[model samples]
Target: MGFDPYLAYYHSIDYGRASLASDLNPNEGVYLRREALKRYFVEYEGMLNREFIRQETEENTTFQKCFRLQTERLASCIQNTIPYIPFELGI
Candidate 1:
């Protein structure tokens, strides 16, 4: 294996599901136990575990709702922001 500190960190945290985000060499596993372990562990362990699926789903839904609301608010703010205007002043 190569000597990449980030890869070590990724393995330590077991970013199996979102491996592409962390793993420097993300690839499909055709005949490796490591692939099997990643599939198993992600489905049965850590934040993405079945036990927390409901919670994770709810959080993502809420995040999307809140994000949409915030973007709408930002759009309103932008629309109401002052517009530039040129005016001549007497010297």
Candidate 2:
């Protein structure tokens, strides 16, 4: 039998094999994923700047904070558009 990949992967497991007729709204899942990504970026930025710097100068600290903020903003933009971009998942 022919099966749609999106239905097979995203719909089948959650609603069960026979209940394909009933599917939850996709918006909630999308929102949850986006929130998770935001949390991940927050955590990642903290981890990246945890190492000691050779120069304990105010300028160095300011530069690191600015860099992390920019990186986080960029990550947020990317996550917002992730749904429009097609991606394949590996099992």
State the lDDT of candidate 1 residue by residue for 25-90, as single tens digits. 555543748888788767544432223212323433333344345556545555687442322121
Q: Which candidate is the best by lDDT?
A: 2
| Candidate 2 structure quality by residue, lDDT tens digits, 1-91 | 2233335324555433432333535343444488899998898778667654324342334335645555465456565754332221222
Clashes of each: 0, 0
**Model 2 lDDT, full chain set:** 0.48
The global C-alpha lDDT for each of the candidates, from Candidate 1 onward, is 0.43, 0.48
Candidate 2 backbone collisions, by pair: none
TM match of model 2 to true structure: 0.23
**Candidate 2, position 42, lDDT:** 91
List pairs with backbone clashes in candidate 1: none
How good is model 1 by TM-score? 0.24
